[model samples]
Target: MKNAIVTGGGGGLGKSICTELSKNGYAVAVLDLKIKDAQRTSEGLENASAYAVDVRDHSSVIEFYKNYGKAPELIVNNAGIARFNKLLDQKIKDFEDVIQTNLIGSFIFASEGVRLMIKEAKKGSIINITSIHSVSPGIGVGAYSPAKAGLASLTKLMALEWGEFGIRVNAIAPGFIDSGMSKPFFENPKIRELRGKAVPLQRLGTSEDIAKTVLYLSSDAASYVNANEIIVDGGVIHSVLMHLPRE
Candidate 1:
């Protein structure tokens, strides 16, 4: 079976990605900071194992690759966090934590994971989970937009450097997903409806939507698709003009 590693696999969207990979016959290593959460996600799928990991720590990441982490055919850098506050109001440390988790964590994982593949002479796919905020910044999301933007740039760099070795790198930037990291925000029915209507597709995105995109990028059909960020936002990113009133 093909081996896959998904960081943040305990979270809502991560679980969906794990399930989709399991269904497609990948033996998955679900990595999360919480062992219990990771175990819970693994329990729902076949050939899935859970691990507690901090992708931000360099030594810890190296130790993981040396011990439990397999040389994966696929790696999904999905672990990230956000703090809600304006730049002036947010604590410096909170902004740092957001950048550390969303950007630095991904760098650590990709660097370590790709080293393993190099040793094993494995050429595979790496998908970074960016956000639509990477393209367009939003107010009150703290450093999330910048972190995701950095991740997008990192995705391109990985592809540029690793493509010669047949390691394809890509990204998915989801917009207004009803589940996962944005779930709490969408819990308000009125706000959810309003946001849904703002989307050109007339609905919010889902975990499955992003998962399927992941699956597509992991497949052989996408062999030539590299260094691209697919936006699965129900066309919400482009609908700002629709909301602008004009007579």
Candidate 2:
């Protein structure tokens, strides 16, 4: 069985990715900071197990991989956190914390995962979960935008460097997904409606929406595809000009 690891696999898009991967016949390791949350996501899935890991801590990540026993053929860098505050109000520590978790954390996991894959002589896929904010900066999200943007760049760099090893690295930038850290805000009807209308598809994205794309990228269907960022935003990025007032 192919092994797959998903960081931040406790809930939202992470959970959905785990489910989809499991369905596709992968034995998934659901890694999250909270063991209970990871267990919750792993409960009903076949061949799925939970592990507690803080991606920012290299030791923690390495320990989890040691215990995993199986070298993963697929690694999803989906763990991240958001700090919403204007640049003036944001603390230096908070900004650093965001980068630590979202950007550097991904670096740690990818490095470790690739090491294992190379050692095992496996051709693997590494998928990083970036965001539309990485392309278009969002207000009050001072740290998130730059962190994801850096992650996107790192995705391409990893792909370029790892291609010789038969490893493919890519990213998925989700927009207005009704999951993860954004769930509660989308629960507000007014905001949900407004956001839905703004999307060209006339609806907000779901965790499954992102998961399907992840499945595709990780499969052999994309064997030759690499160093690309697939934006799963229902055309929101390209439709932004439609919102402007016209004469």
Question: TM-scores, in order shown?
Answer: 0.97, 0.98
> Model 2: per-residue lDDT, tens digit, 70-162?
668999999999999999999999999999999999999999989988889668999999999989999999799999999999999999999
Please tell me which predicted candidate would have the highest TM-score against the true structure.
2
Q: In candidate 1, which residue pairs get closer than 3 Å at backbone N, Cα or C atoms, i.e. clash?
A: none
lDDT by residue for model 1 over 175-243, one digit each (tens)? 999887789989899999999888998999899999999999999999999999999898888887888
How accurate locally is residue 46 in candidate 2, as Cα lDDT from 0 to 100?
100
Q: Pick the candidate with the highest lDDT.
A: 2
Segments in model 1 whose C-alpha atoms lie over 4 Å from true places: none
Give the RMSD in angstroms, all C-alphas superposed, for model 2: 0.9
Error of 1 at 182 (Å): 1.1
Candidate 1 lDDT at 117 equals 82
